[model samples]
Target: MNIRPSAAIRQNYNEIADMCRKTGEPVFLTKNGEGDLVVMDIGTYNRREKMLKLREELLAVEEDRMRGSKGYSVEEVTAMMRNAIREAEGHGTAE
Candidate 1:
């Protein structure tokens, strides 16, 4: 983990942002000897957020399956989503 004191952020904001952009990794900012915050470029932050959301969804699905809930396979989910889109667009179901 790339770590820097919070004062470094106040003093070298541009350099720190540049490092985050170039490295595509978060910079850990510490305050008073404790972990404070993380800084990352916008693109990296968006991608990380999307990945985390997908992981959460996967975990939910796994838990549901473990509880004996009927789960759609990827292909079934894709087909259902496509059909829904078609219906929303006023196109009749292709099935």
Candidate 2:
């Protein structure tokens, strides 16, 4: 949800923004003119705007998992991961 305010709104932007955040609303601001120009509380606005992106990424990852995306089983994955750690720790090839 976004809101647009005239330039006058800037006089009390912080006050209005606090209210908006509390109410889960948004305020769009503009110069001393009509219609909206500047988006308000844009940090939250951007993050909320990316919600679909995040959800889509998660969904795609889940779909990949469902399609057997991994080349190794759990045990194999864990061992491979542990082996990598060991190799990194200067403990090459415990075998």
Candidate 3:
């Protein structure tokens, strides 16, 4: 993990920012020998948020399945995807 003293932010802001951008990872900043803050580039932060959202959605779906909610079959899902692709391509209407 990338780690830096809190003072590094004030002393080497540009270098830290460059490292975050280059590595696509957060830099852990510590204050008084304890974790203080995390620094990451905007793109990495956004991607992380998207991934977390996706995981949450998947978990909800799994919970629904566990509770006996209806699930789509493989063929049904395939057809739905094809229909969506066609609609996106302006060749079909929403069902």
Q: Give the whole-model CA lDDT for all candidates, comma-separated.
A: 0.95, 0.71, 0.97
RMSD of every candidate to native, in Å, equals 2.4, 4.9, 2.4
Global fold similarity of model 2 (TM-score): 0.42
Could you give me the TM-score of model 1 versus the true structure?
0.79
Residue 54 displacement (Å), model 1: 0.6
Candidate 3: lDDT of 36?
98
The candidates, ranked best first by TM-score, are: 3, 1, 2
Candidate 3, 4-93: lDDT as tens digits: 999999999999999999999999999999999999999999999999999999999999999999999998998899899989999985
Stretches of candidate 2 exceeding 4 Å from the true structure = 20-25, 28-53, 62-72, 80-95
Return the clash pairs for model 2, or none: 3-26, 3-28
Q: Poorest 10 consecutive residues of model 2 by lDDT?
A: 31-40
> Tens digit of lDDT per residue, candidate 2, span 1-95?
45555754767777877766676666666555555664446666777879978999999989999999965789887888888988999999555
* C-alpha-based local distance difference test score of model 2: 0.71
Off by more than 4 A, model 3: 78-95
Instruction: Kindly indicate the candidate among 1 and 2 with the higher lDDT.
Output: 1
